[model samples]
Target: MPEVFTAYVRIVDGFNRRVGRIVMYGIFVLMGILLYSSMSKTMFLPAHWTLEMAQFVMAGYYLLGGAYSLQLDSHVRMDLLYGRWSPKTKAVVDVVTILMLFVYLFFLLYGGVSSTAYALQYSETSYSSWSPYMAPVKIVMVIGIALMFLQATSILIKDIAVAIGRPLP
Candidate 1:
C-alpha cells in the first residue's frame, strides 16, 4: 500500500510540475504580448489594460505554481527552529504543518467559492474595457487552494511513512 501510494504521489507530483511549468511559460508569453501591445500604437487598448492583464497572468502563475513548489520543496520556510530538529522530529513537525495547511486551505476554498458565487450573483465585471467576469478568477483561487491542499496531503503521507520507519516505498 505504501509503495502504491508513493508511486501515485510521484506521478501526480510530476504531472503537476509539468503543468506548472507550462503555466509559467504562458505567463511569459502573456507578458510579452502585453509588452508588445503597450509599445504598438496600432493597439486599441490603453497601456493600463495591458498592465491589468499582466497582473492577472501573474496571479494565475503564482497560484498554479504552488503545488509544484511544494513538490520541489521550494516554498519558503523559516528554519530558525526547524533546522535544529532531528529527522523524526522534523517529520512530526512536517505532519503538523501539513495539518495546519489543510485546515487553512479548507477555509480558503470555502471563502473562494463564496466570493465567486457572490460575484456571479452580482454580475461582477472589470472596471475597464475588458469587463471580464470576476467569478472565473475567484474560481481559480479555489482550484489553486485545493491543489495546494492535495500537495500538503502528499507531503504528510511521506512524513508519516518516514516516522513509521518506512523507506517511503
Candidate 2:
C-alpha cells in the first residue's frame, strides 16, 4: 500500500511539474502581449484582444500552477510555530489541516464544474468590449482544483507514513 501511494504521488507530482512549467511560459507570453499592447497604444494601434488574451493566459497560469505550488510547500504558511515542530508532529498537524483543504477544494470543484457547464451550454461571454468565451477558463479551473485535491491526498499519505514511522517509498 505504501508503494502504491508512493507511485501515485510520483505521477501526481510529475503532472503538476509539467503543467506548472507550461503555465510559466504562458505567463511570459501574456506579459509580452500586454507589453506590446501598451507600447502600440502609445505609438500606433491599440490591440483590443491583448487584455482579454492576457486574462485567459493568466487564468491558466494560476489554475495550472496550484498543485505544483502545493507540491513544493510554497503556499503562504505561518512558519514561526510550525517550523519548530518535529517531523512526526508536523505530519500530525498536516493531516489535521488537510481536512479543511479538502473541503474547500471539494466546493471549488463542484462550483467550477457547474459554472463551466452552464457557460458552455449557453456560449457565455464576458460582455466586455473584448469579450471572450468563459467556458475554457472555467474548465481549466475545475481541472486545477482536481489536481490540487489529488496532490493533497498524496501529501496526506506521506504524512500518515511519517507519523506512523513507516518508511515511505
Candidate 3:
C-alpha cells in the first residue's frame, strides 16, 4: 500500500481508539448521575433533566462506540457460516458486505446530517419538560455514522489488499 493510505488507516484507528475510551469513561459519569437522579426522585426532589441527560449520554456512547466495535470485530453478527470461511474468502465476503452496508450508511449519514442541520437551524429541543436542545444529539449521530463509514473504508482497503495477492501494511 501507499504510505499515505497506510497513514490514513492508522489515523482512523487512533481516532476510534480515542473516541471509544472517552465514551467508555463517560459511562461512570452516567452511572453517578443516574444514581443521584434516582435518589433525588425517591426523596421527592426529582432531577427532571437526569433522564434526558442519560438518554443523550447513552446514545452518544453507543453511536461513538460503533467504529471501535467494528475495529475490534466485537459487533454482533450471526457468524455461524462466516466463521468457517478462510481468511481470503472472508475478505472477499467482507468486501461485498461492506459495500451493501455502505449503501445503508449513505442514507443514514445523509439523514443524520440533514436532521442535525435542521435542529441547529431551529434550535430544536425534545418535547419534554426537560427539553434540552436536540442539535448536540443529532450532531453526534452524524459524526458517529461518518466515523463508522471511515472505519469501514479502512477495513475495506485492507480486505481488498489481502484478498488480492498483495500483503497489507
Best by lDDT: 3
Task: Estimate TM-scores for all models.
Answer: 0.83, 0.94, 0.94
Residue 54 displacement in candidate 2 (angstroms)? 1.7
Q: List the residue pairs that clash in candidate 1.
A: none
Q: What is the lDDT of residue 89 in candidate 1?
A: 87
User: What's each prediction's clash count?
Assistant: 0, 0, 0
Q: Candidate 2's residue-wise lDDT over 50-151, tens digit each?
A: 888888878778788888889889999989999999999999999999989999999989999999999999999998887888998888889988989998
Across 96-154, the per-residue lDDT of candidate 1 in tens digits comes to: 88888888888888888898899989988889877777877777777777778777778
**Which residue pairs show backbone clashes in model 3?**
none
Q: What is the C-alpha RMSD of each candidate to the true structure, in Å?
A: 2.7, 1.3, 1.2
| Residue-level error in angstroms, candidate 2, position 91 | 0.7
TM-score of 3: 0.94
> Which pairs of residues clash in candidate 2, taking residues 3 or more apart in a chain or in different chains?
none
Q: Model 1: which ten-residue window has the lowest total lDDT?
A: 40-49
Ranking by TM-score: 3, 2, 1
